[model samples]
Target: MPSYAYRCRGCGDTFELSRPMAEASAPATCPQGHEDTVKLLTTFGTVSRGGSGAPVAPPAASGGGCCGGGCCG
Candidate 1:
């Protein structure tokens, strides 16, 4: 089950619920008993690090290949 966030339009209440994916799009009732609620879009975050436990830096841009520079014409 995944948690879904919802906001009530009737009382401006926000809440979360853990439900099946099939019911993710289903209607939700706010804690205040308001049925006029809408599911809120959610975002996920990821954490990554190098083997040394340091934050990994993005790969540097290549200097353009065989020419060793952006001068291959």
Candidate 2:
């Protein structure tokens, strides 16, 4: 079983539920009993960074700065 985060579209309430992966998701609702809702994209606490490893953001400034002047100046 895994935990999933769901957000209510009616009252903007966020909640988490734990259930089996094969089990169908229940209709999420607001605390006011509104049935109009949706499940948000699931995210994990810690992602495995083995094998290919995690992606790293590129470093800033690729040594292309030209003395605080425009490129064509």
Candidate 3:
């Protein structure tokens, strides 16, 4: 079973559900009993350790990209 995230448009509530992948796209009822719910895009976070056994931080975003005030052309 996989976990799915959903948000209720009726009450603005968020929730998660564990179900078969086949029904992952099925409509879900919110915890508050709202039927107007939609699945939310979810992301997973991973932790990496360095040689010293300390958690490694992610690299900083490059400042030369289109959204970083750099020319895209």
State model 2's lDDT.
0.70
Q: Give all candidates' CA lDDT scores.
A: 0.88, 0.70, 0.88
lDDT of 3 at 13: 91
lDDT of 2 by residue, 1-73 (tens): 7877777777888887677877547775556787787778965565566746666668776535666446734
Assess candidate 3 and give its TM-score to the true structure. Answer: 0.62
Residue range with the least summed lDDT across 10 consecutive positions in model 2? 63-72
Error of 2 at 60 (Å): 22
Candidate order by TM-score, decreasing, is 1, 3, 2
Superposed Cα deviation of residue 5, candidate 2 (Å)? 0.8
Show the colliding residue pairs in model 3. none
Q: In model 1, state the lDDT of residue 28.
A: 90
Residue range with the least summed lDDT across 10 consecutive positions in model 3: 64-73
Higher-ranked by TM-score: 1 or 3: 1
How many angstroms is residue 18 displaced in model 2 relative to the true structure, after the best TM-score fit?
A: 1.0
lDDT of 3 by residue, 1-73 (tens): 8999999999999999999999988889999888999999999987656577677689988776667756665
Instruction: Compute each candidate's TM-score over C-alphas.
Output: 0.66, 0.49, 0.62
The TM-score obtained by model 2 is 0.49
Off by over 4 Å in 1: 49-73
Between 2 and 3, whose TM-score is larger?
3
What root-mean-square deviation over C-alphas does model 1 reach? Answer: 4.5
